[model samples]
Target: MKTDDLISMLAAGNPAPPRAPSARRFALALFCGLLGALLLMACLFGVRKDLAEVAATPLFWAKVALPAALVLGALWASGRLARPGVAVGARWAAIGVPVALVWGASLVLLAALPAGDRLAQVLGTTWRTCPLNIALLSVPAFIAVLWAIRGLAPTRLRLAGAAGGLLAGALATLVYCLHCPEMAVPFWGVWYVLGMALPTFAGWLLGPRWLRW
Candidate 1:
């Protein structure tokens, strides 16, 4: 074949190279996940001693599962949005906001109810610590989780972040539970949710801008 013809054929057969995944981005996500977990655990320990013990329980595993489900759901949503050329910032907000609201509201309502109700006892214990613990640990936790998600390769970031939040929250909550003695479903439903959701929301809002490569 003529040289010109051969060049055209080669160009047609070989498509553009795929973009490489960013190592820096993945590192950022991992760092955020680890740091957030550490900070959250520290807050829980500072407020209540019993929480340290609770952190070791099987029940704690169950609690973490709930958030993991939420995270996976969010990741799936992110993937769908990406296909349509959605901005990363917008996609994070679009998916993160609703999850945070629902999670937060559920926690508030659960906490507001009377703990003496029979149903509350069967789930787990709730010990009241200063709200300050929530403020310190949960808020940061959310930020880290969001940062971790942002670092994920576009295809997996959303879902992975969500799952990471759930796992992190569950671990944090387990620690919180060690010190709490309320043992009511509603109480935990509320306070634990707040602890997990607040930080996640913060991360969602801040991570895109701060962690972006």
Candidate 2:
């Protein structure tokens, strides 16, 4: 058969179906991960006793917002990275902006306090466990988000993996807020970020192996 005839036959009645939007896949993945995190948190430490009271407080939402913002930014970055040949561009800035804001707030808060009080604010009662808990909670989400990314077309495995991992960490950190008692900005600026970083760095390290298409 002629080339034109062959091409026409190949393009005939079996039209390709539309693919699901990446946002929907990511949303489902994130929701699953959040559920897993919630279940894990409930079993491991349970939500804080005064959660209802704290929920009414502005500081509580502020704490929740930090990771929520990172989640939004990382979602944008990860979605771009999951597609082949896509430039991450300004989308990546979404991740850093929240960290910068928290760090800035932390610095101002620390500077305003007396030196002795500053250390306590930064260290909080749960300083040692905060990051560990956040990282631990991120495990489920990390698995979920990476699974979602892997099912798609991610060209830059390392970057895509890192973005996915950050998304997981930010999401888990958001859930962590429900259980975490510490509300100090300094504590969040330091430990909460560190918790999220653990998974992001892990993704970078494992990207080649884990995210390989």
Candidate 3:
């Protein structure tokens, strides 16, 4: 057979791969992870007693918004990374911008506060518990998201793992807002990032071992 004709014949023999499998798996993972995080939060901490009042406050939304933005970026990066040779590209920016904004807000607030009060704001009342709670809450998401990633083909296991971990961490953080009373930007900038970091680091460490397929 002629080279071009042979190539055409081989191409015609294989159907194009389906496009939506990645989307479906990720969507399902997001739903399940979020539900699990919510349940864990409710069972473990209970919703903060003043949720109704707090929900009306802008700071509450700001807390929710920060992680929500990371979730979007991480989800995108994870989905793309699940497929071999896909570049993460602007998705890195998506995850980074929210964190940058939160930190910037925190610095501004710190600058405006009295020096003595600055320590209290950064520490908050629950600095010790906040990140710990976030990391604890990330357990369900960590499992669900990594499972989702493993089901697909990921060439860069560590990055894909980190992305999956971040997605879970962000989802957990979003749910955590319901129970976390610390509304200070400095608190979120410090503890919230640390909380999410635990899972992300774990995923990066485990991706090669866990995600090999």
Candidate 4:
């Protein structure tokens, strides 16, 4: 066959390789997160016997719910971005960076208010507590998710990394809320933002190269 004719025949006959395994990737992410949570709990339990008391509070439930919801949303968003021929960079930045910044800011603000103030009262006494909590719990989960999705052959690794970081931050915040009592808004606005946002950004920047399978 002529070379051009042969090329055309092959192109017509063959299909593209399937992208990375989505289901397996998601499963791995979830598993890694859960493992991290368990490890966090174990470590915390050893350090602070009273950690159970914090876990029993309604705030803890709120923490878990919010982050879980965010994770689900992120998974959906990530899947959409993963589609072929999309401008992954633009889509990821448009969605991921702002969401992460706003989310981190809000959490910090919520943490900083005095416990008796309506918002603060609702959230708890120690705003910084949440970031610490999240750093311990959700960071692992985020790492897991990144690891699972690392095989995708996308050019925008930085964007993917940032998205992954945001997902991790959300999950960590959720777990953090379980143990935190809430605090002044200002306290949270600064400290919490630094704690959560910095790590997330770092993760996003590093994910593409480091997390790749």
Candidate 5:
């Protein structure tokens, strides 16, 4: 057969059925996971005693907003990964911008403080427990996001897992803020990010096994 005629014949065959998209499933699972995390946080660690009054301040809002931003970015990337043949593109960098801005502001905040107090600022009262708490809280969301991914087709397993981990971590942090009294950005920059990193690393390590098609 002529090359052109052979190609045409091959192209004329019936196409395979398309799979349903997983974005909606991912969203619903994520919502349920977050709801469970919130309930857990509420029961285990009640909202900060001063939350009602503090809720009115910018500092309290900033704490909530930072992790919320991460949740949005991570979930967006995770949902993208749920589909095969999709490229993450430059959008990943945009996710880090908010964190960078917060880090920059944190540096400024540190610079303004006296040298003696700088260390204390970064190591807030919960220095030992903060990251652990954040990591522990992320478990529910991580499992939920993973369940979401398992039902879809993802070519980039590691990246998808990391994004799932991030979504879980961010949501967990959002809940953590309600009970955490620390307002220092440097503390968040270090411990909060580390807390998130734990799951991200776990996902990266376990992705190949769990996310395999």
Candidate 6:
């Protein structure tokens, strides 16, 4: 067929109405998943007793802010990944910036504390179960995020998966802060981040299988 005739034929047919962009759909799905996770947190582990008074404190807000920042960065990276052939570019760097700042602050806090008490500060009382709890809390969000990206095109599957996991884990950590009593930056730098990393690791391992188009 002639090129002009083929072009004319292609333009003649009506295309289906355009639906919402993948990123918007993903955001909505993630929001629902987060709500479910929050409900799970409330049912399984209620908020801390002194939360009302402590909510205004720097320590309490610090816990929320770090994870909140990570959530924003991950969401941005994930949104880009949802679109085929789109480079995430500087978005990954944005994710690392919050993490680096939080860790740097943690080191400074540790330095300022008495040398003898540094270990206790890092280990905290809940060291053993803290990361596990965060990982468990992330399950709902992770599943929801994975579902959101299932049909979307992500050329970098592993990176996309990691971003999804990070998003889930960060959201879970935010919910976890309601029940967590630890107020130390060192604890958050080590354990809370480790909790988030577990899901990121899982996503790296599972992304190829689940995200394959």
CA lDDT of every candidate: 0.46, 0.85, 0.86, 0.56, 0.82, 0.82
Return the lDDT, model 4, position 56: 79
Residue 106 miss distance in model 2 (angstroms): 0.7
Which lDDT value does model 2 have at 37?
A: 92
How many residue pairs clash (N, CA or C atoms closer than 3 angstroms) in each of the candidate models, in the order given? 16, 0, 0, 15, 0, 0
Candidate 2 lDDT tens digits, 1-213: 133543453477422112365667788889899999999999998989999999999999999999999999998888878765568887767888889999999999999998879999999999899888988999999998988777665668999888888998999999999899998999999999999999999888888788775
- Candidate 3 lands at a TM-score of 0.91
State the displacement of the C-alpha of residue 201, model 1, in Å, after optimal TM-score superposition: 4.4
What are the root-mean-square deviations of the candidates from the true structure over C-alphas?
A: 9.6, 5.4, 5.2, 7.2, 6.0, 5.6
**Please, what are the lDDT tens digits per residue for candidate 3 over residues 89-120?**
86699989999999999999999989999998
Candidate 2 TM-score to native: 0.89
Candidate 6 residue 204 C-alpha distance from true site, Å: 0.8
Identify the runs in model 1 with alpha carbons over 4 angstroms from their true place: 1-31, 43-60, 71-132, 139-141, 148-182, 200-213
> Best candidate, lDDT-wise?
3
* Model 4 lDDT tens row, 7-75: 454577632114456566767787777667766856683234455776676644544454566566666
Worst 10 residues of 6 by lDDT: 13-22
| Candidate 4 TM-score, true structure as reference | 0.60
lDDT of 1 by residue, 160-213 (tens): 444444434544444444344543344445566666665445444543454343
TM-score of 1: 0.44
Of the pair 1 and 3, which is ahead by TM-score?
3
Q: In model 4, where is the ten-residue run with the lowest total lDDT?
A: 80-89
The model with the greater lDDT, 1 or 3, is: 3
